[model samples]
Target: MSDCYELFLTCPKSLEGLLVEEATQLGLQEVREQVAVVRGQGDLETAYRLCLWSRLANRVLLVLARFPVQNAEDLYQGVLAVDWHDHLMSSGSLAVEFSGHGSGIDNTHFGALKVKDAVVDKLRTADGVRPSIDKVNPDLRIHLRLEKGEAILSLDLAGHSLHQRGYRLQQGAAPLKENLAAAILIRAGWPRIAAEGGALADPMCGVGTFLVEAAMMAADMAPNLKRERWGFSNWLGHVPALWKKLHEEARARADAGLAKPPLWIRGYEGDPRLIQPGRNNIERAGLGDWVKIYQGELATFEPRPDQNQKGLVVSNPPYGERLGDEASLLYLYQNLGERLRQACLGWEAAVFTGAPELGKRMGIRSHKQYAFWNGALACKLLLLKVLPEQFVTGERRAAGDESRSAPQNEPARLSEGGQMFANRLQKNLKQLGKWARKEGIQCYRLYDADMPEYALAIDLYGDRVHVQEYAPPRSIDPEKAQARLLDALAAIPQALDVDPANVVVKRRERQSGTRQYERQGSEGRFLEVVEGGVKLLVNLTDYLDTGLFLDHRPMRMRIQREAAGKRFLNLFCYTATASVHAAKGGARSTTSVDLSKTYLDWARRNLSLNGFSDKHKLQQGDVMAWLAEDRGEYDMIFIDPPTFSNSKRMEGVFDVQRDQVQLLDLAMARLAPGGVLYFSNNFRKFELDEGLAARYAVTEISAETIDPDFARNTKIHRAWRLATR
Candidate 1:
């Protein structure tokens, strides 16, 4: 046996460059970067050192063979060609692991079985015994990977995924993996910089991944110090005395730095629910003295001053997409910007943002940007430099702007010399709207949401943005301007962001109607709109009204094409456009049901506009209530329901999560034998109810059903086509 073996390391994303650096530091050779992984070679000592020191890689594997195979027979011959006696025992258990990317083999398990057969059969012929496959935790684990028509075989040197670092006892919503966290810290320069007293903070510290990692790196701690066991301990080539010495040495090194002056590390989150668990994690890591937890909103925060050097501020704020839509998150971002300017000057900050448009609200240009993954969603970590001049600007404000506009998180402005600046801002926002479309950004707004006085606004919806503004600041009195703003707002509708309803504006505190019509919307007493050769009333006075859903415009166009020849069943059928599509496509009949009589009326108007008045059937009743009555069949159906809602008139509550199974089953019952069910919801976490795979062909047609404009809203709803095989 050789004293050295060529080892290959599989590094996780964001950890690649750091892994190669660490491997070099530990005296390994031939390091290289791959897609989300790093590969290198070393001896047994190198493998052992990596197992203990690799903060970025999940595990290390020993390369066995690199070969080309065209079919299952070739796969068997290749696997059998390996010297099985060198790595596996006749009686030992073994498991075949597999990964395929752009490979001809469609079934991963089939490839794994072929390899397993080759190894076991070869060993059986040589020693009259064969290793059995043990999936849970095999002593001799073999991994097979096929990518781009070539196959790679390797022996797993580390058991488990290596992310179970033994310290994470408590998990919050979407806690990041340990390796990923370590990589991000090192990549952010936490190791080299935190040592120089650049104190760190994660204000919205979700379970303290940043804080914990920063503390560990500050103490020169290894990321995998808490791991209970590793694959090398059981390998026959292991030198027991050497591993023991290394373990003892590592523990001594860690203890040597244990009593050093506590790092000025702190993390704060207002949620009392998170504090106890966060403390639990801190104590678990033996870092209680180094990290502090606080409870409060960022609105009132004061950074600890240090005369030595600027500090570091890093936060992963909730993207508008995290809670729901972009329109709901502008104020949060605005407030974040205000707090940072007011409280965190003289600090380098990294705002790990998934929404670049929202990042613009911070009003500070990012000095650098790093791309990384936060779960499946790709994110941009924006590095911002908080200059010393920021607070100076906030202090020298002029008079007459009693808005006391929270400047820390607001766009910069000058009251006396405002015309040039406002024009620049307006122009930037307009340009941002065009850029957002080209880049296909999701949920980035061009304007701040709480700017109640603006006559027009645009939400860019994400990173692809160019910005501009309109008009100049006039010398009107604050009170008069406020009155005009109120006049502008007093006329819009309740469903402001959705539906084809007109906008209405009404005062919040007025005792009676000053304009005679108290309930009619903002500007629609005599408005008429002609759309698709049909004349319809349009109201832009209220909060919402005056046009169709701009986003769903393409969906309507889709309906007009597909509705002609099929009868339709529209569930939760708001305005019944799908029914219109089915009718226009030459469908025999259309039945639309909804709890809203107003919507049922609107559905009729839509059908009449398309000249399907005779074929259109509108039913104003609770969908849940009417489902059990054995309603008539249709060739096409549309099922769209509110995520969390109740139809009080129907004598029961209808919540999507708790009631999806019954509703989907009901929709299935209403469908014709060969019909397609178009089910959708805006709730991102909605799951298709289980156990109906035997009854119908349920294909998640969400991607296919969504119009071109709504591409990023993949989780908005799931559609299914159902039919017996």
Candidate 2:
């Protein structure tokens, strides 16, 4: 009976703004963007039009009910409150999709089961027959979201996601999602370019997602034309007459658009097998005449000799998702860049990649980078014009400068805030330089987020400087953070008298457990540096943390001083820097435990470099499990656990704040009488449990553990020496 209904259009993450624009363009009323979804008010025709025409939407859902729901009972009753007989028949099939978690329904499967039970109960009570559950092809699909104790139920107008346009019968390994491909095209201004009669090409098209989506946009083809199923198709409330009329109108529009001059859309693929599938998908989408997919290597990709056209070259290139994928793919990216530079001179390029670092290897400066989500992977769509002037010869410019007269090699002038940050870095260097020289220290932290505006840690590994910019809060403008990062990078080389090439930039985000230890890349270019009179290997580019922790310099030194003629144990030892120091200081034997084979290997190399043999052991296992089994007593022990880790290798999630008491108890049990256990963690808000402190002789030596190099920020790591009461 309602003329219009509240509707929600679900989209891939990071495309809310784009979807909002699309909804506005569709003339939907009260259009607003929410998290990963757009809300609007529209009649049945408006909903049908969006379901047909929207290229960026995943699903068009019609909101049916909303109410407070705390437990499974509340959810079931709330669902029952909606008259199921009005929307679905008792004999029909239905499916419920559950997302998010809350008070009673902690798991999606359980939540879905409860919703299903409620629907079945309501239907059976009314008509003596219950609807059957169909996961694959349901007559009716319901979407339930439990967010912040409120449940919003919606009927999925599009049975499956609109992205599954029914045209993609075949795909290659890691093919881009259709809606994601469309989002990338829109972000790259493909619609505008197509409007001006620009051609479209994909040199590395995987199953032709980009090309097909581009052709559909160019010809105004309804994306859902080939999709056979709709949620309302079997529903009792569906106005079949109205729906048929809308479908005929959409078909007419598609036919009229296709009659115009065909768009120049071509997809080139190196894989011979993928060509057929790509072509099949294009033809199925009814764009066979508008787009072409051909078997061709990236090296041979070029525009047709007769066409003489310039347009956009968009691609969703391989992002090296697996191990060993990067070793070969890095060169692929570089070669792709070369081929584009040689073949397409006037064309603009857009690359959608989950690995931005590999995109960086292309050696092309991206003019705009928009964040998008390819499924769960956070990816970026990089837009750049393929011009000779945009290419860099040596080191890339720290920042884009508009002045042509300025020397390309010269450092760009910093902003006012950047100037102040530079001055502070210089001052810190002056203050720390004397101490580092006097102590014969080759590596140390020069600045630690000294200026809040420039939240970066500048560490000196001999001549090379590692700069890690902390990811700013969501409240801060990303452009402002990028500008500040560039300012810091520009300032470091000039301030420290180091070459720009020696400077490595990395963005540091708050990480949990093993994620902090995961390798960003596998270059494994190790740099030998001296820390606390010990030689250590530190890699700046391959991982988030350099193999060595400069803040723990004092802790390692303390271990060395106390480890003479004593047994040393290092728990959660990454790279075993502490064990190396302990072995060098005359420990009877040293044991280092870590879960990662890569870091364990690095730790072995460190011990060998320090001339400590296998007598000093390195064990690979979960530290907690290892500790529970170990009966050996150690006079000196170091336990440094990650803040939180939900690694599959471990038994359960490890929370340093919650489990520290138990962890400390286990470590203390392994310590001999009067033996010292240096327990430390980098979790900023970590609080020592009162119960554990009361049980043991715990002394908070956090202040004393910070070295002079990290003097500016004493809370880099919290340390305490504990022993049995």
In terms of TM-score, the best-performing candidate is 1
lDDT tens string, model 1, 594-634? 87775566677777766778877888887887887856876
Off by over 4 Å in 1: 101-104, 123-130, 305-310, 322-324, 389-725
Q: For model 1, how many clashes?
A: 64
Clashes of 2: 1
TM-score of every candidate:
0.58, 0.57
Error of 2 at 171 (Å): 0.7
Question: What tens digits encode model 2's per-residue C-alpha lDDT throughout 582-692?
Answer: 998899999999988989999998998878886799999988889999999999999988898888888988899999877888888899897889989888898989897
Error of 1 at 80 (Å): 2.5
Worst 10 residues of 1 by lDDT: 491-500
- Candidate 1's error at 596, in angstroms? 6.9
Q: Give the whole-model CA lDDT for all candidates, comma-separated.
A: 0.63, 0.83
